[model samples]
Target: MSKKNKNALGGARQILDMNAFDAGAEATERNPLLERRLANVGAATVLFYKEPLEIVSASGSWMTAADGKRYLDFYNNVPSVGHTHPRVVAAVTDQIARLNINTRYLNSVVDLYLDALKATFPAPLSNVVLSCSGSEANDLAVRIAAAASGGTGIIVSENAYHGNTSIISEISPSALKRGNLPDHVVTVPAPSHPGQSGSIENAFAADVKRAIAELERRGHKFSAFVCDSIFSSDGVYADPPGFLRKAISEVRKAGGLYIADEVQPGFARTGDAFWGFARHDVTPDIVTMGKPMGNGFPMAGLVTRPELLERFCEDTGYFSTFGGNPVAAAAGMAVLDVIADEQLQSNALRQGNHIQERLRDLATKDDRIADVRGAGLFLGIELSQPGEKDQPNAELASSVINGLKDRGVLIGAAGRFGNTLKVRPPLSLSQDEADIFVDRLADALAASA
Candidate 1:
């Protein structure tokens, strides 16, 4: 780590114990929202939906909650670059102080922004349409996919979660709003170990083939096969991108589109490549992005082949008041620049290697930690029973998460049973910070045992 990173890590370490002095009766009373939020989350039995002690501010890879407590943040995959990164903040601020408006008129920021973004994708997938969030981008993707394929059925992973919009929710098996049992949606199991032995890549391809075959048997036309290329919710599986090649080929043969949802795993969080789909060595028909693209400035977009999007334009126009405006473009541009200039992608590669090594060692020591899987920055620590077939233990997972929070580190959990601890920190996290995080996580694991 550089001297700057060393100092920043030291500063975060210093504030870890500050909450000890005042995290008491007065603090709880003053923030009634913090207290009541847990009750609401508990009433619903929702996973990690509570207010979470009201973090007052955040910068880089650390967040300072209400009680003057600072915690190392390893859960915010959306802050792809970093929290309140000075360059991104300045870019947005400078643009807003000058001029920011719709795309009805030509703007340098929007044009320059699109140019930089287009360089990240394959040549055929060059055009871009911006939106304010991943949900909105996914919504636009649905319109484009439906238009391009002339089909209504969409295929997704069994526990996949695309977004919260009605169309996305219908396809996302994780959505509890309407039970996610939509008529036009086809769900298939995601690729993971400990389930089937022979090449999970083959299993994924078979699943896609089976889904398409079933759709054909039922005389149903499929619009698209949508998947998070990294599949964060399906236990952070990032192997065998070539595994989906046959499935995608089948989808295309069936006149369906292949949509890679990169909302949580975009912008080089997966390391090795800018888009998670690139890791698979397959170019997607349509790609949706959000979360880290703006580094928390509410900017996202759908990029696709001009030919694919043209079908939608022929029918109805897609427009959002806040999409691709100057401010959003500026933030997005800054994030891209930081990823290149700061070499944050390389940093994610190195730090993720370190984290994975440590976690793997921990898993060997304790059989409860079923597995550790993911590609750079995005990771999942699976919790299971002792010497058993990695069954989901949601209770133990929650205990470890709350325990880590108490120790001044934050992480997110996903998977169908909410039993995997998702550890996707900011891409800018340093080696020193990684050490602190690993130490604390080990402490949490010991406490759980």
Candidate 2:
């Protein structure tokens, strides 16, 4: 293939593959379980690190492998509260034992959870639709936007990965490897701040304006502008809070709904606010969230204005067989309880800021560490060629990932070029754990160099 074609293919790296384990393992690296996993999943398996760990159990901020090795967990966006939090565990176990049934019949636990969940959002977003995954929530949001706006156009960030469903995959540019995006879908560059300008807000808004015009020219009516408020997949760009307002304004002006895909950054993950979009000061027309909702339990959903949901319901029926069962509701309620009772949100803010400060100090000394930015625990350390911030150094990122793993810390990579270390530990991460991670990271960077 031509050079440009090869570059295009390389740029299409899927979100999960940034630090994924290749099947081509050396003989010494292969074990019976690893062999069985490969044989079972075949080409569909997506493991982490050069030597994937067989995790047997987990707790707050840490995971234990089958061989009894423990690693500080920093790569999980799920279980935002923490892994196997006792409150969530007790709640799920008790509820499942008592009664487990669908939402077709009235259930107090479900309503209580729904009410508690709604209390977290704005008043206008009163209606909630429970679902089984973030993918389902996003899929419904897309249809609702189209139904309400009478439009088919959708816009997303260049490397956005919303979900794995067929419709969602079409809109998720990072997931498309062998084909061009459908005409109805278009992408905008990620919001990048060069450490010297407040121009990112205006520039991103202008990009949205141009994307809307492009959609119009393509004969597709603008439906919705979907994105994670943190822009996690687009390299964890979160700064100058309210930078998204202008772009969201453009989306609204064009009669397109703004759908905040909070699957990756919601439920107090962003510290400054309960929801990631809250940091941006933008009101999403439809907010979809999952993964952490049940703290690893299978539950996800969307919240929207009543009128928009009413409009969508008029066109089609909606229900999920396992969406808001009592067990899921119990798990959801427990997650909320843990976040509040233990003050995990405050902890996340403190620990995240501490790590960011340390990383920033390191960045000042290390030319290869390009940038340190993110909200709360959802932070990123961008790697670049030494003394050349503009040039991505994915190789250095890969080296640091393995190095960190060897140092008893687990992390991952992100961004379109896969040079940014994605640091998203549990909200309950303590200062000591945070310090250990940063120290190990410094060592890893030093050793890699």
Number of the top lDDT candidate? 2
All candidates: TM-score: 0.89, 0.96
Candidate-wise lDDT, in order: 0.81, 0.90
- The most accurate candidate by TM-score is 2
Error of 1 at 442 (Å): 1.2
Q: Compared with the true structure, what per-residue lDDT tens digits does model 1 show for residues 19-104? A: 12222324433556644654575543322323345678999999997789999999888777889999999999999999988888
**Cα RMSD of predicted structure 2:** 2.4
Per-candidate alpha-carbon RMSD to the true structure: 8.8, 2.4
Candidate 1 wrongly placed segments (more than 4 Å): 1-30, 35-51, 177-180, 193-197
* Tens-digit per-residue lDDT, 222-254, candidate 2: 999999888888889988798999999999999
